[model samples]
Target: MSGDGIEILRLGARGDGVAADGLHVPGALPGERVRVGPAEERRGVRRAALDAVLAPSPDRVAPFCPYFGTCGGCAIQHLAPEPYAAWKRGLVVTALSRAGIDAPVAPLRDAHGAGRRRATFHVRRIDGRAEAGFMAARSHALVAIDHCPITEPPLHRAPEVARALARPLGGGGKPLDVQATATAGGLDVDVRGHGPADARARQALVALAGDLDLARLSLHGEVLVQRRPPVVPAGRAPLVPPPGGFLQATRLGEAMLADLVVAGVGEAKRVADLFSGAGAFSLRLAETRAVHAVEGDAGALAALDRAARATPGLRAVTHERRDLFRRPLLAPELDRFDAVVFDPPRAGAEAQAARLAEATVPVVVGVSCDAGTFARDAGLLLAGGYRLAEVVPLDQFRHSPHVELVGVFRREGRRRR
Candidate 1:
């Protein structure tokens, strides 16, 4: 572990130098040296020359989870905060660059502390009790915990109830994920029975509902009390979200997003917000212009309706709950808008990109999480007579590889295709 000289494993999907050892051995990262193997074993699984993995930090405060080393959930926890911050920033810039979009990622922005408003925790019955924790990396295993270092404080108290309910099910207890959402009212937990929550499981969950100071309670996948019904941010109307709706993790994140959308869209009067879940961008866009929000989920469309009614600023939000992937917006449909502000899921906006390329719309603001998908879709847009305009990366999750970014694109003259 001397001067940054080490063998590289496979390049990360985004090209970060992966460890040659194929494991994050407690105190190592990219740019530090790690001694590998017993001679003959070193030649396994094609290697790269990124011999610069990093070593652990002095303030590396031990990760609390027992499964930290094996769990795939976090990769850079062992490194010092300084390097991990850089890695988080890297995910954004690299993703934007690969998409060939205009990303002005000069002064990287970082959001820290305990403001993560939502987290989905899986629950299971250990020996005689239920254990609750996050899903380990890519596996079904739950990383059981007493406290999660990264979540808001209230979340730590939830496991107490989770374990009590899990105690009865014992070895046969089902697996469930608790989504603690920070709504306008307060923190609401919606429980979805993922693996094996049964009719017998209802009582435990009901008791759990009584223990916490939750605004709303849900058990066995059903809403129990209307302590605080879901609300669309703009409107006072109740938002009936899709079964697994996506909600922003923080109020700051939501407000910042609205600001970015308003700034990016400029003065475009007619616009489309694709994958418009509860009108995250569409509702914001409605402040200045009429926006057509497109999504496939019926519940989300209902939420969109509720939001518009409550917030008059978003009165112009019209929704189409049609699956964009199956039936893309036609050329006639495209002609109605001058721009687009789309925030698609990690899958990226393949179908919408196809239709937008043929449109007269001049601007497209894309917010994406998956790097490869963004690049692929961007390539399609470029082929369709558009050029990358600007890129902005969001570091919402720290000490982790996952990053969010916004890429701005504008229509250019056609050439090849």
Candidate 2:
């Protein structure tokens, strides 16, 4: 295929370079000229494979990781720091503008302290050996790796551990996913994609755990061996999260988000934490104010309750397990709380936001990972006469296109049409 020289204009949401004619070239940076292969239409956009960089951009820098283009984990690592931060902050501004909102967005904050504390490794068999690593970009093929540079020191050897654990379950003849989390005790691991283990397999796993010196090991949420509790620190309390449960990517990221939440809920006596997982924000808020944490996962809620009960000097901390998507807390129940803090998944809390719009809560703080959904929910709150005070974007997952944000809204007056 003949190559064509295309001038890169800007970056798309996924970190791909865009041309004036809407052509997307992978691995190309803005303000550069790149040679690309034959173009093909994909999902209503023209895309081409980057052959070579004829003229590199001034912001381009050598990637630190060896698996820069191969591994699907990090993107936009080649761009300089200033441009990278600008692009990340621009994502929030663009999303809010599209949602018809005009709010002051703070600069992107760096929260990638000590790198990621948790990671999931994909295991697969090739030519009679089990290999563990991340998948290729936009491909199902595995890119076997020895170590990942973006993870914390404790998780540096997670790939090796995942490969060893795959041996017990047919040497990864079937697909397997190993999730490793670095805790205060030791490495907490969970294996998935295999059915229940029998007596012999379970015994082998227990012995392997002993050999690996793992704090806890589980298969599909069933404990195999627990030498010590995998305790993770949240505020003043310690929590033992459930097997393969959700957690913030980095330790510093969680602390930064919790700080913002506490500051946003200033002077509020009663606070309600929605979608509170393992009491990341609730436990911190309970230091002074009474907190009522509501979540869908019973195990997570149980963990939060245990942490709250075990910790001393905390205020009244209560919890309830309910799916907010199906039935959000109505205005009557929400009116009792002075403020509401919700940190939801990528889907955002549309139902709960609608209900909060109807309530008279003085303060509402939203924590989200998706800018588009956050903007949509912010619009809903604005329509209900809530004024968006501030929106702060945090870069927890460094080098990735993803970003996390926190938005504070205050009720201006009565509900508007």
The whole-model lDDT of each prediction reads 0.64, 0.93
Worst 10 residues of 1 by lDDT: 38-47
Candidate RMSDs in Å, in order, are 4.9, 1.7
Give the range where candidate 2 is weakest over 10 consecutive residues by summed lDDT: 1-10
Error of 1 at 101 (Å): 6.4
Clash counts per candidate, in order, are 19, 0
TM-score of each: 0.81, 0.98
Tell me the spans in candidate 2 whose CA falls farther than 4 Å from its real position. 1-4, 415-417
Please, what are the lDDT tens digits per residue for candidate 1 over residues 1-417?
Answer: 445446444335332345655632333444445554322223343333322235532434565555555545555555555656566666666665766655456444565345566777678766756778777654677778675656666666665545654554553276766776656565577666644456665565555556655566665436665465555364233454533467766556666666777788788888888888877777677867898988888777887877677774444778888888888787568767777877888888898888877776778887777666887787778888787776666666655666767778878774222
Candidate 1 runs further than 4 Å off:
1-27, 35-71, 80-82, 92-104, 165-172, 194-204, 219-221, 230-244, 414-417
What is the TM-score of candidate 1? 0.81
Clashing pairs in 2: none
* lDDT for predicted candidate 1 compared with the true structure: 0.64
Q: How do the residues 152-243 of candidate 2 rate in per-residue lDDT, one tens digit apiece?
A: 99999999999999888989998999999999999999999988877888888889998888999999988888999899999999998999
